[model samples]
Structures are given as C-alpha cells and as structure tokens.
Target: MRCAQFRTALSARLDGEPSGLPEVRLDKHVARCTGCRDWLARAQRLRAQVRTGTADGPSPEWSARLLVRLGEDRTGEQPPGPR
Candidate 1:
C-alpha cells in the first residue's frame, strides 16, 4: 500500500476500526514501513495517554464555558458588553 493510503487508514487501524482486507493490508504495511510503524507507535502512545487520564480531560465547567462561547460566536453577540 502507498504511504498516503496507509496513513489515511492508520488512525482507524490503531482504533481497531478497519476490517478484513483493509485491516490486513494496513497491518502488513505497518510491519514493513518504518514510517508507518512510527506513526502507529505515536498513535498507540497518544491513545494510551488519553485512556490513562494523564492527558487533560475536559471538565464540566470547561465544556459549559466552551458551549457558551460557541453560542455567542454563532449569534454574533458581544457577551453582554463585558459587564
């Protein structure tokens, strides 16, 4: 498989989202391509970090603030004119 093709499916492969033929192809490509192998390693590390909570997790307050900001941006409002 071409590097671009393998790259496009790399994330899905790491996430176990590929299936059958694509999965096999990606697997073989990863095994043979050092570049793809590095990408897979980085993806796996990032996924593990996210799962283990070492990475930042969005808090409820942050989500609320982000939603409020998004709403304001969408409506083109000035957030109550900054008090």
Candidate 2:
C-alpha cells in the first residue's frame, strides 16, 4: 500500500478499528518507512497524552484569537491584527 493508505490504516488500527493490513505487514511497513515511522511515533505520543489527560488544550487566548479569525471569515472584515 502507498504511504497515504498506510497512514489511514494506522489511524484505524490505533483506534482499535479493523485496519486491512495484518499486524505483521503493518510492522514491516512501519519498520521500512522512515516517514511512517515518525508519524506513528508522533501519533503514539499524542494518544498517550490524550489517554493520560496531558494533551494540550487550547487556552483562552487562543480561543479568542480563533473566534476573531472565524468572525473575519464570516463577515469579510479583517481584524486589526496580523493575518
């Protein structure tokens, strides 16, 4: 399978869904593909953080910034700050 298919399967597998690839093949792919290996490592770290309640949460400051940006998007009026 290509890298994109492998990534989609990896996500499903992580979520305990049925990934089409068997475990052995998945391991082989992960072992050989440096990009996939790095992606898997990051996904594992993010999963760990979420499981342990250590995942980064958006702070109030960021949330307000997002709201402002979204408002600009809806109204076609740019906020008086950096784009």
Candidate 3:
C-alpha cells in the first residue's frame, strides 16, 4: 500500500472501526516504513488520550483567560464568550 492509503487505514484503525484487509496491508507497510511507524505511534498516543478520556478537560489557561474576560465584561466590555 502507498503512504496515503496506509495513513487513511491507520486513521480508521485508530478509531476502532473495521478497515478491512487494507488495514493489514497498512500495518505491514508501517512495520517496514519508519515514517509510517512514527505516524502510527502518534496516532496511538492520540487514540489513548481519546479512549482514556484524558483529553476531555480544558486547560488552566483557558479558565484563567475566561475569568479575566468575564471580569472585563462585567466592567462593561464584552461577554466572556467564544470568538
């Protein structure tokens, strides 16, 4: 399989959906291709983050900025709403 095909299959596999025989081909390609292997590692990390729910929460800076914006809005600027 080509790099593009492998990447598409890899994405599908990460989502846990059936990707048919193409996925096997992509997996084989990844075993032999360093770039594809690195991509797979990244995909696995992101997948783990999604599956384990570790990516669900917001960052501290987001809340801090929100509070600052809220304070500004209360002082008659604009609401602390999303852009």
All candidates' TM-scores? Answer: 0.55, 0.67, 0.62
- What stretches of model 3 exceed 4 Å from their correct place? 67-83
Give candidates' CA RMSD values in order.
5.4, 6.2, 5.5
The model with the greater lDDT, 1 or 3, is 3
Q: What residue runs in model 2 are displaced by over 4 Å at the alpha carbon? A: 60-83
* Candidate 1 segments exceeding 4 Å error: 19-21, 56-83
Candidate 1: the clashing residue pairs are none
Q: How well is each residue in 1-83 modelled by candidate 3, as lDDT tens digits?
A: 47877777778877787665565676678899999899989888878898888876778778768767666533456655677
Candidate 3 global lDDT: 0.75
Worst window of 10 by summed lDDT in candidate 3: 72-81
In what order do the candidates fall by lDDT, top score first?
2, 3, 1
Q: Which candidate wins on lDDT?
A: 2
Evaluate all candidate structures by whole-model CA lDDT and list the values in order. 0.74, 0.87, 0.75
Error in Å for residue 26 of model 2: 1.2
Ranking by TM-score: 2, 3, 1
Candidate 1 lowest-lDDT run of ten: 74-83
